[model samples]
Target: MKILVCIKQVPQKDAPLKLNAAGTWIHEDVSYEVNEPDAYALEEALRQKEKHGGEVVVLTAGPARAQQVLREALAKGADRAIHLEDEKFVQLDSANTARAIHAAIAQESFDLIVTGLQSDDFGAAQTGVLLAEILGIPHATIIIGIEKTDTGLRLKRELEAGHYQHIETTMPALLTIQSGINKLRYATLIGIKQAKMKPVRKVTWADVESKISPNLQQIVRLYVPEKQKRTEMMEGPAPEVARKVVDYLRTAARVI
Candidate 1:
């Protein structure tokens, strides 16, 4: 089995975010790390490879700084990497992004592809779906477990309300992995040294420009919501206060 794992570099969880001057997106001057869910997906891929005896390749599309995630993945256990490098990719919608990836790896063959359930920054949860759609492959989302079978694969999907659903599918499939699927392994000194020797193929914007269509969606503006505090004390008879509270909730708060 040859598995392709798609990872993303995103702003660190605790990093402060600021809007750029145009408010079109967040400033890119913050610390970045491998997207959490994607990390889990990568871990799952590595684990699968360890058990099945196959190659694990990692892919990421982002700005130059994004190469850090690729290096980290290579150090962790990815056999090699493919980097879609360009500053403009930051503006690409899920559709165009998937198109770019398809264009880059059009000739490569893989039995399975893995991606995160969602991106931490955008939280769109659409790129993996779009990729699978563009590739015309069977895909499963929010998968937390994967069991290899003689014929194909068995997957455990996380559902709302703490529920789970099991599924079976064949190879040449894609999957969107949920976080906490496996324990992430850190790169050791030996792994770090070996990663430096790993191959990372770079695919630039110019390489796949023709394959990408004009973005159908773009972020018009991004801003932090303003915070405010308001408090009111009701002083009256119990029945009147109760009526007022109920009315406030029904009319203003809209909770009821």
Candidate 2:
């Protein structure tokens, strides 16, 4: 089994964020880390490889800083890494991002492809589904568990309200993994040293530019909401106060 895990680098959860001067996006001069959910996806892929005896390849599309996540994946036991280097990746919507990923790996023969349920930054939750559609493969989202069967693969999907459904699908399938599917392994000292020697193939934007389409969506503005406080006091008879409160809610607050 050759499993490919798609990971992404995102701003650290607690990092302070500021919108750029143009108000088009967040400033990029902040700390970044492997997207939390994508880490779980990588962990699941490593477990699958350990059980099935095959190679686990980590893939990511981003600027140079994105290599950090790939290196981390290599240190955790991925056989190799593929870096889709492009500065524009930071602005591309999920559709164009999926198209670039497909262009990079479409020639490779992978039995299974895995990605996080959604990216931490965009939270669009559409890349894996779009990738599956671009590749013409079966896919399942919010997968909580996976099992290898003699005929194909069995997957446990998470549904709303704590429900789960199990389904079987053939190989060459794409899956968007939910976090906490398994325990994440730390990189041992030896693994860290070995990762430096692992192969990291780079695919430049020029290689896939033709395949990528213009972003279907773009951020128009990003800004923190202003905080405001207001107080309303009503002093009257019981019936009058109740009516006034209802009117305030219905007209001023517009919450009724």
Candidate 3:
């Protein structure tokens, strides 16, 4: 089983965000780390490799700083890595991002491809699905468990209201893993030393420009959400106050 886990580097969870002058994305001064969900995906891949005796390769598309995520994945247990390096890739829409990724891996053969459910920054859950569409392979999302089957694979997928569904599919498929499916493992000192020796292939934007699709989406503006507060007090008898509360719930809060 050859598994490819797609990882991403995003702003650290607690990093303060400041909009750029153009109001189109955050400043580059904040620290970054491997995306949380991607960590789970990598861990799941590592587990699969340990059990099935196969290679676990990781891939990421971003600027040079993005290599940090690949390095972390490698340190954890990935056999090798692929980095689509370019500043332009950082702003690409989900579709083009998927196209670039597909272009990069067009010649590679893998039994499965795994990715996080969505990016932490953009929260766009479309890239993995778009990649699956481009690859024309079986794809599943929110996968929690994976087991090898005689013919293919059995997967446990999450559903709303704390529900889960089991599915079966053949090889050469893709899946977007939800977070908390597995506990993440930290890179050991030995693994960190070994990761420095691991192979990390860097593919520049110019290398795959011809294969990339034109952008289908645009970001007109990006800004942080504003914070606001409001309060209202009711003064009257208990009965009147209770009636006011009910009316407020039915009108303003709309819980009823």
Candidate 4:
């Protein structure tokens, strides 16, 4: 089995964020790390490779800094890495992003493609499905568990309100893994050293521009939400106060 895991680098959880001067995006001068959900996806891929005896390839699309996530995956037991290098990739919507990813790896024969349910930054939760559509493969989202079978693969999907449904699918399928399905493994010292020697193939955006379609969405502007506080005091008879509170709830709070 040749499993491909799609990962991403995102702003660290604790990193302070600030809108850029144009208020169109966050400032880029902050620390970044492997997206938390993507880490879980990589962990699951590694586990699958360990059980099935196959290669685990990690793929990431971003600027140069994004290579760090790929290197981290390599240190965690991925056979190799692919870096889709493009500064403009950050601006592309989920559809275009999926298109670029498909262009980069479409020629490769992969038994399975795995990705996080959604990116931490965008939270669009659409890339994996779009990629599956582009590849003409069946896909399942919010997958919480996977079991390999003689004929194909069995997947446990998470549904709303703590419900789960099991589905069976054949190879060449795509899945968006939900986080917390498994514990993540840290890179050992030996693995870290070996990762430096692992192959990291770089593909520039220009190489795949023709395969990319125009973006369907774009960020118009981004800004910090304005914060405000208000206070009201009601003093009257008990019944009158109760009636006033209900009126306030209906008119101001809109909760009644």
Candidate 5:
């Protein structure tokens, strides 16, 4: 079983974010780490490889610093990694990103391709489906669990309204794993040392021929949502205050 896990480098959730001068995306001045959910996908891939006896190859697309996240994945037990580095790809939408991945994966046959349901920064859960379409493979999203069967792969998917669906797919498929699917493990000292020697393959968008051209839907002007605060006073005794609170919930807060 050859498993390919797609990962991404993203700003830490708690990291202070500031929009750029053009108000397009966050300013890059602080440190970054692997996207949280992608880590779970990596962990699941490694677990699958350990059980099934195969290689887990990690892949990411970003600038040079993206290599840091790739190394971190290597330390976590990925056999190797591919860094898809290109400046033109920095602002590319999910369609273009999936195109690049499809171009790269076309060269290598893989039994399974795994990725996080979405990136933390973008939260566009479209890549896996698009890549599957490009690769012509079955795909599943928001997968919380996976079990390998003699005939194919069994997966549990999280749906709206807290529902779950179990589905099965044959080999050469794609899956986008949801976060919290499994516990993430830290890199051990031995693993860290081993990662330094692991092979990290670097590729660029120009290196592969794009089978499809990118049709950009829209140029995003990223901006942080403005923060505002307000306070209101309730008059009268406890009962009146409670009534006011209920009114607030019913009208302003909309919780009721």
Candidate 6:
């Protein structure tokens, strides 16, 4: 089995965010790490490799600094890493991102392609599905569990309302793993030393542009979510207040 895990370097969730002067995306001065969900995806790929016995390669499309996440994945267990870096490719939409990834995979054969259900920064969740479509392969998104069978792979896909759907698919497929499916194993001292010696290949956009789709969308602007707060107090007798609270929960919050 040959597994390819798509990973991304994103701003740490708890880091303070500030939009750039042009109001397009956050400033790049803050710290970054592997997107949290992608870590689980990498772990799942490692587990699958351990079970089936094959090479697990980590792929990422980002600036050179993004190679940090790729090295981290290698240290954890991946066999190697591929960095697709280009300035023009930055800020591409989900479709373009998927296209770049598909182009890279076309150069090699992979039994399975795994990625996070969604990137924490974007939360679009469209890249994996789009990549599957481009590759003409089956895809299971938000996968919570996976097990290999003689003929195919069994998957548990997480759905709304705490529901899960069981799916079976053959190899050369895609899966977007959900977070919390497994504990991320820290890179051991030996693993860290080995990662430095592992193969980390860098590929430029131009090297694969012919295989890439020409249609690429541009982001007009990106902004930090505005901060707003509202407070309301319902004053009445205990019974009345309780009734109002229940109504609020049912009608206003609609979470119940």
Residue range 1-256, candidate 6, lDDT tens digits: 9999999899987899888888767888889999888899999999989988999999999888899998899899899999998765667788888888877767799999999989988788999999999999999898999999998899998899988999899988999999998988999999999999999888898977776665566557986667788988999899999999999999999977
lDDT of 4 by residue, 36-142 (tens): 88899999999999998999999999999999999899999999999999888888899988899998997799999999999989999999999999999999999
Which residue pairs does candidate 3 place in steric collision?
A: none
Q: For residues 21-122, what per-residue lDDT tens digits would candidate 2 score against the true structure?
A: 999988899999999999999999999998989999999999999999998899989999999988887889999999999999978989999999999999
For all predicted structures, in order, the TM-scores are: 0.92, 0.92, 0.91, 0.93, 0.89, 0.86
Clashes (candidate 4): 0
Q: RMSD for all candidates, in order, please.
A: 2.3, 2.2, 2.4, 1.9, 2.9, 4.1
Instruction: Give the residue spans of candidate 2 off by over 4 A.
Output: 231-256
Q: Single out the weakest 10-residue window by summed lDDT for candidate 3.
A: 211-220
Candidate with more favorable, higher TM-score: 5 or 6: 5
After TM-score superposition, the amount by which residue 234's alpha carbon in candidate 2 deviates from its true location, in angstroms, is 7.6
- Regions more than 4 Å wrong, model 1: 232-256
Steric clash count of candidate 5: 0
Please give the CA lDDT of all the candidate structures.
Answer: 0.93, 0.93, 0.92, 0.93, 0.88, 0.89
Candidate 6 or 2, higher lDDT = 2
Error of 2 at 134 (Å): 1.4
Candidate 3, residues 56-146: lDDT per residue as tens digits? 9999999999999888888888999999999999889998889889988988999999999999988999999999999999999999999
Judging by TM-score against the true structure, name the best candidate: 4
89-110, model 5: which lDDT tens digit per residue? Answer: 6677788789888877677999
Local lDDT at 222 for model 4: 85
TM-score, predicted candidate 3 vs. hidden true structure: 0.91
lDDT of predicted model 1: 0.93
TM-score of 1: 0.92
